[model samples]
Target: MTLSQPTDAMHRKGTIISVCRIGLHDIPEVLSCGLQDFLEKPSHYFFALLIYPVIGLALFLWASQGNAWHLIYPLLAGFALLGPVAALGLYEISRRRELGLEIEWQHWFSALRSPAFPTIGMLALWLLVLFFAWLLTAEWLYLSLFGSSSAPSGPLALLADVIGTGRGWRLLILGHLIGFCFALTALGTTVVAFPLLLDQHVSLRTAVAVSLLATLKNPLPVLGWGVCVALILILGSLPALAGLIVALPVLGHTTWHLYRRLVRIDGSVAIDPKG
Candidate 1:
């Protein structure tokens, strides 16, 4: 089956209804679908994953320059370059399931035919929010450490200043708080929201609410997943972005699975309208 072709009406509706009814227990089936697709059409997934290293290298090299503004251009460029790849990865997964076919590299471009402008616009908005969150967290950490002191003249000096102070515990607490807040706001919506947006023409409010409800319903799994993601992030930072090549792809794939486990689509079950 190909994405360009439609499944039988009965099968299409039935699959969706079953998925909506069984909910998280349907995760194994969903993952099986994704795995079959991935194994059959490895190229698209591989290529999509490849963009991570390219973007990571670009960011690392740019950051090495220590120029604040220089970082922005590469960041924007990386997003522009990688956003489509990430979207393609996601689209292939959805298209594979929709068509009941093994994933194919050909399907990678199918998402480009989706409502491109709105998708890209939403992605851009997401990036902006992420950037601000990072900026705020960094600023808070710096202030907590330096106590509003003047900027240190050199990287080595700055490191020395930060390390010399007995404020490591304080900085850790501040960083943890920032991370917790960011995680709460971001994770609640992240699991299903993006995939929901891509798979269905749903409003952001509905997607976000569904995502949050999913998290709240299965807090342990969600928290474990969060820990896994945080560990990946910490690893990515340690290698000066080299780790992102692995981390990003894993997170992207895992997140797709997370969405499959969480959101309902067949309308077999009714979400509380008040929620």
Candidate 2:
């Protein structure tokens, strides 16, 4: 990730950065609190979900404009890479709640300029690179498997080529396999960066490194939480994409709590934080 700068206050640090011990049970606990947050201000999160329709529309239009309907799969899947950025507001809300602040609606918009916005922005560009890389890789896979010489008339034609035969089956498995690797990297890199940046003044590198370190420190719990997020998002995307209205924010809020649960030390503190 490429961070232009941390906030001015980041230089006058007060917290120390250190890893925390996390257990499997903590997953459910944080999730419960996340759900509670959503339950309390469902409307705030509901508005957050509204962004998905716009994203869906953009994807739909992009796919429609070309013969590359196969590109849509990666585009949709890459949406997860962008998930952390989308939930920035939810992180602010959770931070406000943690500080026992007034929980003003203004926090939602203010989160756009979050204290560590530059760091998070760099982290975002990194994810976007991964996102487009997946798209390009998917395009290569489709072209290689189906041959560049062959041209499909439309989405249905492309669908048949990728699902209608043995070659198609191979493409499906290999494509998913490759895509899973991308998704897993995204999950690890960003699982905690947003909330960490929201809550502390650490630089982009420190925030991302800690996120990866936290996952290593608490592998099973982090992986399980990642799985839960993936499953919820995948299942929720069905049934007219309405489920994201609840699933996204609940996970967003839950993720902030998960960040709190995982990051026991902040580098801004007096005590030196662990690597």
Candidate 3:
């Protein structure tokens, strides 16, 4: 598809990214819309196909180490932080479907060819850095709390330590609070930026500015959206991450619809496209 067709003079000057007001009610609505999109285009094979490499990489990194169980919770929780990057292809699917274009697995590569690809890469890099930072922080916290002791032997032993000890309880409370801060940062930075970059020809600054503004305008709903995503991801992770084969695509599609609801691009302002 022609992702970079030249726009009118107003659009060339840059379109205004308008943030719309929404409510807690919009969260469920967008989720319902996302599920409908998933049902309409059940791309189970598509996501299942893509996830294998990630699983392989994770297995290579942690599977051989018996003591890696301490970081398992952190790794699972950090999935939300990098979700925007993972959902890029799914966004393209939703975008094409929304525009009544024919869908194909080939079209999943559309993000790679977008005019905003470099900027998209930059935003994705930011998320990657955030993900690594989270993992480091989690490791440090674990060391600070229980490093003096030997690492737990397996998932059950680790679970017992966490649920059976005072320091473990402290880790639980602090880890979640710290994790929430990271999640909020990610939500504000990318809640609109990634989809906007995919849907429009805009600079990184403009897309990010609009995303932050949209989150500010609808703080409660956006927060609710983050919470809902975390809950779903947690539940999806329960079945050895097999559930994500469905959960990730559905969430990805829902995010596109949520972005449509949260922002309205208008020909009112001039933004520098190069930024």
Which candidate tops TM-score?
A: 3
The digit string of per-residue lDDT tens for model 3 on 187-261 reads: 998998899888886788877777887877778989999999998987877777767777788889899989888
lDDT scores of the candidates, listed in order: 0.53, 0.76, 0.78
For candidate 3, list the clashing residue pairs, or say none: none
Evaluate candidate 3 by giving its C-alpha RMSD to the native, one decimal. Answer: 6.0
Model 1 per-residue lDDT at 196: 63
Cα lDDT, model 2, residue 103: 66
Off by over 4 Å in 3: 1-14, 44-66, 268-275
On a 0 to 100 scale, what is the lDDT of residue 260 in model 3?
83
Please give the ranking of all candidate structures by TM-score, highest first, separated by commas. 3, 2, 1
Question: Where does model 1 exceed 4 Å of error?
Answer: 1-41, 67-88, 94-99, 116-120, 147-160, 236-240, 267-275
Which ranges in model 2 have alpha carbons more than 4 Å from their true place?
1-14, 149-156, 266-275
Highest-lDDT candidate = 3
